[model samples]
Target: MTETARPAYKRVLLKISGEALMGDQGYGLHPPTVQRIAKEIKIVQAMGVEICMVIGGGNIFRGLAGSAQGMERTTADYMGMLATVMNALAMQSALEGVGVFTRVISAIRMDEVAEPYIRRRAVRHLEKGRVCIFAAGTGNPYFTTDTAATLRASEMSCQAIFMGKNGVDGVYDKDPKTNPDAKRYDAVSFDEVLRKNLRVMDASAIALARDNKLPIIVFSLDEPGGFRGILSGQGTYTTVSG
Candidate 1:
């Protein structure tokens, strides 16, 4: 890798599952894991790239899981949104620890904790070189964080959305963990992803990204420098677009 490599995109959104923060633990955040990921983002930001982030709340509470357990769907979803906020704060603390300025912007208003999601304000923050962590899943109960990430990336005019997976390196035809023969594609189409139910993201997210003609780069978050490597155009990952 180059000592100081240039990033491919001027601006991008990083979407990771809440479980990525859990590290080796069964649930919740692992401080070391969070810090490690923060350092990766710091490396990219140092290359003069603007970043937006959306972290899912599966580590704390999954709205769908809660609903499946007989809880009210909307209420459970709101609870899940709050979980994302907690994860965002944890990430914000880690990023700041590495000397990267960050702002936790929430779709739902929570001025005491995070700034309310105002499009102009969030874009300004990115223009000023701040990593904006978008929390609270679109402020809507039915939407998943995947859809929220796509929406935010589109609104922010991000060049692409990077879906950082924990163990899997890229989008596979089947769950690699379950099926060893699962094939990985260097690049796949949005229509195919939706057709096969590839599970890279939700249907809504995939459709929205397709409609906007935005690219989604899926890579391994577990690799030490995977995120930065991608920004530098030195990584192996799958691209889902058009």
Candidate 2:
């Protein structure tokens, strides 16, 4: 039998929201959600694509939301980072349970629980076909995981960053949920995203991608098997390129 073809991208950075791990509960880690994400990543790994994931903590703790409610900004941000760490561990357990080799690397030092963030070591892990889950956002305050995703993607030299949004298939001219007249874009330039003020990702994240010439693929994570399909270029998604 002929060998199956590998994915086009040799390395990729997947950015998932904490809510994606919540399933139907709308809060906290849901077992089935984590397992499904793990399965998708496993499929990409099998296709020879080195995967590094940066999962958000929005479901557990959104720093901005807390700050809006009268909490200290830095403290809230740190809590958000910790929330991401928890999500990362949950994902790690799910991935390892299926016999997929993985590592959890945290920006903040948590030696007993995970490896501290080391750029070289992260790249090494990917080269060895081990999935690396990056937790903690830039290890500091005033930054979102979206920025961290771009930073990690640039550092890891990933060919593209896969943005797994909860709903809505891709970036649209307007909020599809709010406007029926919203137009979906198949492909777009980073400049246009900024010009149009699209919220596919934060401005900082989009700027970084533009500067480094990294493409961002926006797709709905809720779609069954969509992640694997995107890597194979068979999914409904928007490609933002330089």
Candidate 3:
């Protein structure tokens, strides 16, 4: 799409899982994968879209998984939050390497590592064409990064949240990986998503987005130019809204 073709939304929050940065590796950040996604963000940003990002830390450590392994719940969660900060730093480096101004803002107070998340400051970054990467998952235990994305999206007054999945293209009636005949919904209501218990996002995240009337666009990060194409209204994605 050309620069003359205006995007569907002005400002958007992108929520990508840390696993998306892992590439074929079982764990840790893959430089090439992070660079690829960072380039994608750069493309969209070039179109004058103010961007906010919240990356999950599942590739490093999952709070629930750590807790399941007998670790203390709060400690596991704090570790998970730290993992997100690492991912955010990696992403910041990649984005900067690609000439995109980016900031890693953490919900937790870690001045040595990342700038503490301040709502107005974050908004100012976006207004200045700097991509704001929110880290640390709300700085609290038991809250998923999904919820953080929703909360930040709302606070930033983003038009929608773009959720980039690794392999899955969009939300489905069943597990497409396991079911041969799963159907993908082009558009779905937030209430329906919660009522059916679909995995588009966790229940808390979905409910938060629902209550605030924020739309989520789920698309495939595996697709080349998929994020940009979706914003340009030329890609297949699932829209979850009221």
How far is each candidate from the true structure, as Cα RMSD in Å? 0.8, 1.5, 0.7
For model 3, how does the per-residue alpha-carbon lDDT over 47-133 read when each residue is reduced to its tens digit?
889999999999999999999999999999999999999999999999999999999999999999899989999999999999999
Better of 1 and 2 by TM-score: 1
- What candidate 2 gets wrong by more than 4 Å, as runs, is 1-3
Candidate 2 C-alpha lDDT tens digits along 1-242: 11275677999999999998998898999999899889888877888889999999988999999999999999999999999999999999999998889999999999999899999999999999899999998998999999999999999999999999988799999999989999999999999999999988999999999999999999999998888888776879999998
- Model 2 scores worst on lDDT over the 10 consecutive residues at 1-10
Question: Distance (Å) between predicted and true CA of 230, model 3?
Answer: 0.7
lDDT of 1 by residue, 158-239 (tens): 9999999989999999999999999999999999998989988999999999999999999999998998888877777999
* Global local distance difference test of model 1: 0.95
lDDT of each: 0.95, 0.93, 0.95
What's model 3's lDDT at 206?
A: 95
| Model 1 residue 46 distance off true place after TM-score fit, in angstroms | 0.3
Kindly give the number of clashing pairs for every candidate.
Answer: 0, 0, 0
Give every collision pair in model 3.
none
Question: In candidate 3, how many clashes are counted?
Answer: 0
Q: TM-score of each candidate?
A: 0.98, 0.97, 0.99
- TM-score of candidate 1 to 2 decimals: 0.98
